[model samples]
Target: MNTNSTEYRLEGDGASIQSLPKISLHDHLDGGLRPQTLIELADEQGLEVPAADADGLAAWFTEQSNSGSLVEYLKTFDLTTAVMQTRAGLARIAREFVHDLAADGVIYGEIRWAPEQHLARGLTLDEAVEAVQEGLEQGADDVRHQGGGIRTGQLITAMRHADRGLEIAELAVRHRDRGVVGFDIAGAEAGFPASRHRTAFDYLASQFMPVTVHAGEADGLESIRSALFDGRALRLGHGVRIAEDLLIERQDDENTYVSLGPVAQWVRDREIALETSPSSNLQTGAITAWGDELVDHPFDLLYQLGFRVTVNTDNRLQSGTSLTRELALLSDAFGYDLDDLETFQLNAAAAAFLPLDDRDELAELIQDGFDEA
Candidate 1:
């Protein structure tokens, strides 16, 4: 997480995008581990890795995940999660994840990871949560000590394909006073809609826990429907497919006439956050309906049409990207400027699971930092 003395990046006399403050809402803990950290952790656990060196290992992940299969892409997590079976392993990765985020200029981030997947080494659910929380706090302190500033929170996740939804829900609520701030449901989104975990959703609702669900990424409108109706999700994780509800009637020279169906209209009017990861979405075919390129991404359309679309790095290791890189790519693709970046951060700050007062504070912090840059 070293930004020391690296001149603030300004491209072609334009403002430096890297120096602009940003908010990260959909980062994953397991998906953001460093290659060297994975190597050392795996060696500690006596696990076999696909590559021996850090560069070799990073290349292997990049290659394996290039096959364009979500399940295949997700297989890389097995190596990371294997090393993370121990408390020490989890702590180290979480700490380094925060370091990387702070270095990338993230002022606020919510790191999401499923606790159930990290308990293979005899660590109880609460024990694993405490370990990550410890690492996050330590990492934040480390960043502050390094003259960088960042605030991070955990969004406890439950696998949609798993049956421990209720257990994970309670775990999230149990740790709310500690470090956990919100709940999320990730993994396969096609068959396993949020309705499958109605019991967990009900429990979270009773506890007044905030929710964000992975929907409309792998599935279509019905999945998003279930996410809002069943999961009560305030944010839709990569809900780009909600664009399927749009009816493009014609395109004129000035304005393209389009109509939003009920679902799309509801999401637009309600201001649900779409945690869209440009590169990750392309790799997973989340934008195949539009095209296979970043330009084909409906991000611009969503943004132009007034959807609260926020950029994210869904999996940094697998996507081989950072939030800075994501922003750079988006700017390159769409010709966005500093104001657009600030708007996205403002959207994320508004959608944060923190209390209204805290969110307002974050918004002011974001405005202050970006204005200075």
Candidate 2:
């Protein structure tokens, strides 16, 4: 058995999970900033920070996010976004985000951030998107120079409660060939259903743009229904709450009898990916329907039922987690082995917004990496 970091090693062989190839589909840009970088940027921008130092600020973020309310969890982003109003800050943050992902063994990642939220300091929507794209390219080049391989794409997000859905959707489409991979609607999931953004979804559908909606996280099954039927999302961000649609008739030591509702069955049979962020899900009360622990997450159930379940670090810093750490926690909670971990990576690769040929290449890469391990 070979072990470096015990927290990120396989239980069976003690192989480093951090060294395995992985894909990220639901990571947030502002939420994944390095603590030191956040402190520096906040100081440079002359903004008041919650804490004077990196460690303190990180602790504050974790505390604030543990309020068990999605609204409260989102409040921490104000500080992160406050420093990201300038192009330099956005580029620097984006570059560092890629570096962090590569260091965590993510071969491919889609970084999502709302462009509209960064326009306070006079950056136009197009400028914001371009700045992030430039930073992503620079970061990828930096990784290549360091003898590491990492590919990244931006998922331009629209704040769900805001009135700029169409504008943000257009922004994503406008930069499709640049660095943007797809479109998403984030922010509060309750009062603002995807129906409010129907026009934007219709436009994206017409343009053949792929979309993933933040549904079934803070809301219930109806929210997921709107995301699929109205937003036409190909994936569900933290859609862990779809388990609410499941009805368990009985369970025995060897077998369990269950029934799937229409929405759950549609998501399962259609193979729409569920981007489950276990720690963040627990912090934001997304899995309150089950229990207050990682073992209570519906991810294993979804996987066992053949749902395309993908693991993710929704907000790395807030959760104090990497993709490696998230996978490790799940493995510990569910007794998963290397093959289960590989399946999750392959599921993410298959659901990535990249083209068919690129996804096929990513799958081959993942398979080869796991074979090496």
Best by TM-score: 2
lDDT, candidate 2, 1-373, per-residue tens:
1112345788988888999999999999999998889889888878888888888888888888898989999999998899899999999999988888898899999999999999999999999998998889989999999999999999999999999999999989999999889999999899999999999999999999999999999999999999999999899999998999999899999877879999999999999999999999999999998999999999988899889999998998788778998999999999999999999999999999999999999999999999999
Clashes by residue pair, model 1: none
lDDT of 2 at 109: 99
- Put down candidate 1 lDDT per residue, 1-373, tens digits, no spaces: 1222244444554776667788899999998988988888888778899899987888887788776667777888888788888888888888998988887889999999999998898999999999999999999999999998899899999999999999999999999999999999999787899999999999999999999999988899999999999999899999999999999999989897889999999999999999998889988888889998888899999999999999999988888888888888888888887778889899999999999999999899989987887
- Candidate 2 local distance difference test against the native: 0.92
Q: In angstroms, what RMSD does candidate 2 have relative to the true structure?
A: 2.3
TM-score of each: 0.97, 0.98
Worst 10 residues of 1 by lDDT: 1-10
